[model samples]
Target: MAHANTVLINALRRTANKLSSGTSYQWGHMGSCNCGNLAQELTLLSKAEIHEFAMAGRGDWREQVEEFCPASGLPMDLLIAEMLKNGLTTTDLQHLEKLSDRKILAGIPSEIRSKMKYNSREDVILYLSTWANLLEDELLEAAPSLESLLKWEEPIPIPEDILL
Candidate 1:
């Protein structure tokens, strides 16, 4: 699950980097950019500060993107949506739209799926629906801490009371 989270984080970072390039505003500012002030609001760091830390004269955008990912615990679809808001091309939008339906339903262990009552087709659909709505609400809130980001990766048994 940590691996999956890492993959999702990397995807979001890539999307953010792509969106950042097309915007006219500086990294930290609120408007005229896809992710609100996310680039700026994070770490309370100035543009120069973030540049010094992430860029470090390497000049690789991918590295910078990785640095940004841990700050946003969001899964990739919401990240992609935020990027699209900044002006993703149609092809990019199509790619991102596909992700929304895929991530929650992809490759879970049957044990875990069964726990969610997702043993059948209809259950999986409902799981996806709930996950989508939960993600929408989750993303609009503040960026999560790295620990919170990691916590979601843990596989634990749900109490019977909670399951019902």
Candidate 2:
């Protein structure tokens, strides 16, 4: 069991590193190109707008901005809250938490999850990060041998032209 845990942890760490590194580029691309598409129909300004307003205000504008913006559409706050409720954070183990009451507000932002019609990009990232962290712990617990680690089910033979 310890061996299995170690192998799994290493695999998970590799996967998480890959995912996190790729995610920065992916997020940059999405924000640049996709935000316009996502916000096309949204008349409401984002929380960033509210923040800017607060920053620009003479004194104690946070409250006024909070009242003004109120975080209507899809954003991180709603997304994080939902993630917390769903038990998708690092602390969650059984993956049995209830769906957030603000599921609609927690709409997914990524082109991938969007096409899949799931949660927003931020939500998906958080979800995967949480799982990856958990799997890392599991790997540490297992501590599998390298031989057992390397042995996955063999791939079936492919045609010569199709082989990579």
Q: Please give the distance, in angstroms, between residue 102's alpha carbon in candidate 2 and its true position after superposition.
A: 17
Per-candidate clashes, comma-separated: 1, 17
Q: Model 1 clash pairs?
A: 28-40
Candidate 1, superposed: residue stretches over 4 Å from native: 1-37, 65-134, 138-164
TM-score of each: 0.23, 0.22
The C-alpha stretches of model 2 lying farther than 4 A from their native spots are: 1-117, 144-164
What tens-digit string does per-residue lDDT give for candidate 1 at 15-45? 3443444424332322212222233332333
lDDT of each: 0.37, 0.33
Give the alpha carbon lDDT tens digit for every residue of 72-125 in model 2.
533433422332332223222112111121332234335533443222444433
- Give me the displacement of residue 140 in model 1, in angstroms: 10
